[model samples]
Target: MRDRIDEEITFRKLEVLLAFMETGNLSKAAEALNVSTVSVHRALHSLEQGVRCALFRHEGRNLKSTEAAQMLADVAQEVLTTMSDGIRATREAAGYSSDRLKIGSLYSLTIRAVPGIVIDIKVRRPTLQVELALGSNAELLDKLKRGAIDAALMALPDADPEIESIPLFEDDIFFAAPAGSPYANQEAVDLCDCRDETFVSLGEGFVTYRGFLEAFRVAGFTPNVTMRVGDIFSLMNLVSGGVGYTLLPGRVRGVFGDQVQFIPLKPQFLMRQTIGVSFLRARERDPNLLALMAVCRLRTRSVI
Candidate 1:
């Protein structure tokens, strides 16, 4: 009988049923689940069929829960709540609870923003342990989605529906050239003027690369091919060595000191990258995540 019931009813079906009971409207329940209304209807219908009972009554186009449905909904709520508590308790026992937050970030932020943010969080929660992981924006986002990290600091706009973000600050993109380069003397350089110059860049997956490509597109010319490197420092080194010019955020201006000169792009082609903290919406209520978010809000406001 236990096996039979498990085979018939699913956890998702129970969640769907509870959503319907709480919202009292199929469309609202669908919205809450990030699913279509038809999917909600189908799940509820399948649930009723599996239980071999009528859980809802149709009053015109609306669904009203039956007495049996109400009882089941109560039980489902209790089960889910208990399961959540159990998971939390287990994680705590394993030292993977709210006291420890895994944070992921883009490699570029490691030089400045990330260190400051981490320091702020530490000052607030002295007992808290933070694990910092640095990677490309895509890698950080992927880690965030997999729950490998509690939050990620990356560039916007991230279109993933499952992730929620807080815009911390905007960093302007600049044209980088060697100190001796003629373009370095200008207050602002037109990208079109550099159309024939060799360009060094952080290959495709990097957010800076996308911004670099878009700036060129807006400038009405494709940059001459030269080098594609993995990290920003190396790309900057190459630029400082007079290998080619590259586009980078102003935040990284301090990295190579005066070795490379950063010039603002022409107004029409000006670009700014929005840097922010992103996390799964499902973990929004986690205490550690909430604390980190508060710190981010405070620190970003002070700096930016």
Candidate 2:
């Protein structure tokens, strides 16, 4: 019984019929659906065979829709509409936000990456509103875990069973100094050699702070004490104003223009931040998140 029903009618055929009815011709329907004219003709023919009736009749050189075809087109439109609405409602019940996507991000990313990503997402979903929540990496992660936001853009955290990540890009930690500093002329800075130099840092909750601590741990000594700031932009400005040197991700290199010099770190003291989107493991199938993941992947490819 199931096989007989499946053979007699199919969703794909309904879509083709609706396209044909709306477009008024084989080639036009094919163009609307992004399929070949031959495929459209074949689908309509197969649809007529399945229904065991005449859907189109010859008139001069054109095929005009018969009464059965017109009737089927009306039913097809209703069925497809109900099915689409049902699917969307089902997804919304399962945690998909159909109207707005709330995104959390590190404040640093807003300077270079977030603007382009937001613009592209808008182009893809014209009616969907995007809200950006900026905070430290830890803060963003907490919001994401609590459902305060739909997804987060920040450094990848340690592997967890409840969280999923899509890595967009990797950024190297650079030693940033005021433009007139002695280190400005050097190609690279050694973290171990700078054990006595004063340095600025994002607060402990920031991802870059984790990198800062880890690099020093690898260097076998703690960095000299200076003031710490709550945001990356302030910390960068502190470095630019000659308050103290700081380690920063390469992504922010363009933020300060020529005021700050970004130098690479020697190999043993090197660290890189893998920045990406993070979301709930169970909600990976949410339509909004899936679209965001697709956008992230596509944008990453273009950047590469």
Q: CA lDDT of each candidate?
A: 0.86, 0.88
The residue ranges of model 1 lying beyond 4 angstroms of the native Cα positions read 1-96
Cα lDDT tens digits for candidate 1, 1-304:
4546745577788999988988999999999999999999999989888888999899998999999999888888898888888988887443346668889988888888888988988988889999999877877877877778888999964577788999998999999988888886899989888777898899877899999999999889889859998778889999999899999898889688899999988998899899999988777777788888999899777764
Error of 1 at 222 (Å): 1.8
> Which 10 successive residues of model 2 have the least lDDT summed?
1-10
| TM-score of every prediction relative to native | 0.69, 0.69
What is the Cα-based lDDT of residue 254 in candidate 2? 74
User: What clash count does candidate 1 reach?
Assistant: 0
Candidate 1: clashing pairs of residues: none
Residue 8's C-alpha lDDT in candidate 1? 55
